[model samples]
Target: MSTLIAGTPLAGRVAVVTGASSGIGEATAERFAELGAKVALLARRKDRLEDVAERITSKGGIALALPTDVTDRAAVRAAAERISVELGNVDLVFANAGVQLISEIGDLKTEDWDAQIDLNIKGVMNTIQAFVGSLEAAGTDGRPADLITTSSIAATRVLEKFQVYSGTKAYISHITRLLRTELGRKNVRVSTVEPGMVNTELPDHVTDPDASKLMADLIHQIDVLQSADVAETVSFVAALPKHVNLTELTILPTAQII
Candidate 1:
């Protein structure tokens, strides 16, 4: 079986990335392709996924764009099944679909809370449910399989006005750790990548005017980390030796804390 090394550790592997239309998810998909993995990009926007797939194909990488919404269990399952049929097997799964909404507990809208929970929490569960079997099969065939989920520093640090968003991230961190315990014996690695203040469309999902202003201010005050930084970290974790599992990684700019 081939292994991902520093240069191109993902060579000959198959990776399925959720929320691949933009931001960290898209960046991670591109990086996986660059490392020689056959990548399947799954997202709701067919046009955006196709564009990314075209770019990968143009660069001599193998890619398939599957229009999907991670929040939909049936759709996510179908996408995984399609990848298994077409790409052979999934060696890695990135459960990266997430949203950010900032609202004070007193002022929080129920709909905003539900949206965040559905995407950030339920979506990760859906991705894992859809791909764990394929990932296990990949390992049985002597291929190392990995499950990487995107969490956030919010999971650890709770600030004012981010109650629901922080809670959702905390759930991700908890569930990934539990999965690591359960899957370790199966030789299927599980890892969570926690990033701080990344520059992405995550903040754009915020609808509250006051909350958005506060978040924008905080983002501008700090040198917000880029999606590429987190994507590189994802690659590094996925490239580890079969026996080596990086259970958790938290990355933040040197100048930022909490």
Candidate 2:
């Protein structure tokens, strides 16, 4: 009922954010809180989530730290139920849990591939499955319910050593688009956000030396995208008018050609 300029557009709204321990997910949760949303932070790190919740609560925003592994369907479901009971029906769900382990196809690490598939793909599915019902149930209360996933530019670009990671992201991007078609009729908006070279722990998780060096060089050469940049994109999409759904957004640094 409030405008983004006049006051908190998300005031009185309930938002659930996965991967809230750090990076873009954490930034987005904090931004949502600043906009007066009651935020539920979900992640595997209880300590980190607690720290984030403390920061939000100290600033007069409501926050709940729920340590959850997105890869676990039952746990994700339980966390969603808890948030619904404690805060209210979720108006926004940020399915942002992911991992980036890069290696060339010839030297592929099967374990790493499995880990990426589980978190990057299955995790996204679990997050959406857990909260979509709530979003569907929440009719247009002046603003449409939103579900946004943190996809990546790798979905479309063929970054060396990122075959598995890119594959997972591509799946997410396609899935989000399909969901929009089904959920739009119910006033539930689904969006996929693809960001390029964000300064986050994602690159830190890279194990391949060549890939690491390539990423490091890119970061050093170009003014890299920050977590807040992606977070701002998430907030903007969430704050848009009910009829205006930004179904897909691709954010890249000016210098980033890929």
Candidate 3:
């Protein structure tokens, strides 16, 4: 994310990214660090999180990996406390952790639905609760602060077998808007990035045969957005002037009709 970007615009800032184990989360964290922001990585995949932190450090960047289950509010809070002591108050946060489980409505994949709800919706709430205080403080002190969430084009696109996933993303997009009512007053920028069909490990987790085939066909047919592409867009959102807030951003490949 940094190599493509021009200067150290984010220097001296502290940024946190959830779902840092892979894909968008990993790309965003690395980019922020490269831009000179102290980074904290949060994810359930401890090994991968550590690996990501090592990659940032190898590049002479500062990063702290804190393995966390974002669904658990308590764990999120604990990690926030540690970040405060070690990295100072975080000024930018990318609540990017989420899961995609595609299944038919008649199939009633309760487990899959629960997993998406827990990690996508509940996890976002936990992250916001854990760090909003610091963001508020930063804003009150006339500092730059941002709270950004990773939503999806599914929130508005009507895709078959993506009912539950779409609902979860819709919640995220709308919630970001609502959060701005208060956080914006504090001078903290709150926004959401909704990306279409990024080529990532997310699709590999699809269990339904028809849904999997549909996603496969789409990827094979057209150019899909890469995780790094989304990361760059997100980094742009964060690096924007504090007075400007791109409240909702939708990123998609030029060839992607949907």
Candidate 4:
């Protein structure tokens, strides 16, 4: 009797994950590598990317660290080119590089707003733009590609002091929907992964006292989500058959309520 499981489902596939330095991005890259995919790790932090790549290579998985700032279009394109040369055509891409700047409506912090918009919105665009051509080409060659974006549950649900961050995520959420419509015919799958209350350094970047307090309260109230949980979801989605496309996935802690 043969088992109905295939090991290394992503064997021969190349995956690119932005924001690979830590948290969800790091976990996704490691998960992809574990599943036998050659992973390209992209982030602004060279040391962190190198560390993640070292762990992957040490575990007998292929990984390449390409330090990049997703907000820069040229840097993202160059990183994509390097991935093409080193890992072959990318079969999967996780546009997960993002930052959260939480402030109340009256705070009037234009810099925080700009930071969130640039990294969360433009960064996502740069990643998608840099890889869409390759993904489409891969499809034409009979290999369907997957594009997954890391959104936030805040996009759909209201969260205090998350106004700008939520708006940016919502933008990407709709953009992902549009991409799915545009790329479906070409056999490229586009999806968004929205998570809630993940215990990551994301909240640490918040400067608003009220927002920080809210984050702390949320963490104390519910079972916090983990980077591994999101990573598992990403791997599961990526491992599915090419014909299956999970358009949007919202992952939340069981104890959390909208």
Candidate 5:
């Protein structure tokens, strides 16, 4: 069992977690709440969001479930505004919502490619643009605030049928690096978590039959990392001291490989 020492590191802080309906996002929200942060859960599914919120509340943690679609700029902005108004200045923002599609270039559908770009790229942009001001505002207190995003190992390695998906993740990595440079002077920290072979709904989005089979086989071949693994990493980054920023972390199951 992992022990949680609670009091100062994240006490009285407010965090917004996008894609909080399930998977890594949901896990991260729960972990943050456990660490004494008031958490805002944002995702498109109202029922699912409420469920997560209820879980946190039941556990004696503060939580708000805001049904949101990260792909919609206006919705994202409104969510951010509401968090600022209700939760006070935001202390952390986790742009953890994403999708994946795998197909060969010849068989790849244009619409699918666009979907990946919009959510994986543009969605991230909207989250950052919406909450950046809040992060800046929080910095005035002389404490470091954080912005974290989830990228996959695919970003670094180009696997056989995941061209567009890999492209989107690669873009995430690039944006994270640039944002780190841009936000450094502002006392806001930016970090990226790259996870490999996690057991989640990621494979459900794979439309290509061949690719789906391949992914399933790979999962069976390894004791895939769980969503909790990535969640722990997010909490670790958030718990770091003001001047110490864990820039990037890559996690993979012991049996998995590039």
Candidate 6:
């Protein structure tokens, strides 16, 4: 079989993925590299970031591993400067750094709620703040620019214990809609990918025993979507024609009712 399909579809493009250490972020970074985009990975895990970058480089793909805590604006901005100097203008950004801490509203796991708010909501805002300038510049240069955010079906679905997590994701979904109104005028595509029950480490973080069992049972009951599945959708969005924008997509496993 021919490797990498036809010509490099994303040749000369620059992609930045937050939470690029694992799951959807890592998969999408590798996919972007496969299509010839110079990729920059930003996340808190230094070791894992290096591992992803090493694998991509081994396959003759260019990748930059920038260990960053997305909640830290200064750190994110510093990393953005490095990306601009090393990878050129970043036209593609995936604000995918997030955590799912599910618990009942009355239980009041305030710490868990804070963690979700910091990483899922504030982190996304920081990423957009760092990259929007470059994305706008790319648009001015008549190039395709895209900003994609990873949300979850929990955003809309009425789950019992996913109060804070759902709220955070809903923030992401709506923010993407609002961002598109402004960035879209500049020809920078802004979209959100809302996946339903993806088989990712996110489920492992739920400390609520009831919620954990519910998630475990759901995973066992169906073939949950994998990280690669979501990555493919994200890459497809970025690879479309410059004028085409797939605004909001909800990806669900065939067996998943929601």
Give the TM-scores of the predictions, in the order they appear.
0.94, 0.95, 0.97, 0.95, 0.96, 0.96
Error of 3 at 40 (Å): 0.4
What clash count does candidate 3 reach? 0
lDDT values of the candidates?
Answer: 0.87, 0.90, 0.93, 0.90, 0.88, 0.91
Task: Report the lDDT tens digits of candidate 3 across residue range 1-258.
Answer: 234678888998899999999999999999999888999999999999999999999999999999999999999999999999999999999999999999998988999999999999999999999999999999999888999999999999999989999999999999998999988989999999999888889989998898898778879999888888898888888888888998899998788887
Clashes of each: 2, 0, 0, 0, 0, 0
Q: For model 6, how does the per-residue alpha-carbon lDDT over 1-258 read when each residue is reduced to its tens digit?
A: 123234578999999999999999999999899988999999999999999999999999999999999999999999999999998999999999999987778877899999999999999999999999999999888999999999999889988878889999999999988998899989999999999988888888888898898879879999988888888788889989999999999999889886
- List residue ranges in candidate 4 displaced over 4 A: 1-6
lDDT of 4: 0.90
Order of quality (lDDT): 3, 6, 4, 2, 5, 1
Clashing pairs in 5: none
Query: lDDT tens digits, residues 20-48, model 1?
Result: 99999998999899888999998899999
Q: Please give, for residues 106-130, the per-residue lDDT of candidate 4 as tens digits.
A: 9799999999999999998899889
In candidate 5, how many Å is residue 150 off?
0.3
| Prediction RMSDs, each to the true structure | 3.1, 2.6, 1.2, 3.0, 1.4, 1.8
Candidate 4, residue 133: lDDT = 91
lDDT comparison, 1 vs 4, better candidate: 4
* Model 1 RMSD vs true structure: 3.1
Candidate 5 runs further than 4 Å off: 1-8
Query: Per-residue lDDT for 1-258 in model 2, tens only?
Result: 122333698887899999999999999999899987999999999999999999999999999999999999999999989998999999899999999998878875999999999999999889988988888887455456999999999999988778999999999999988887799988998899999988888889887999899889889999998888888778999888877889889999889887
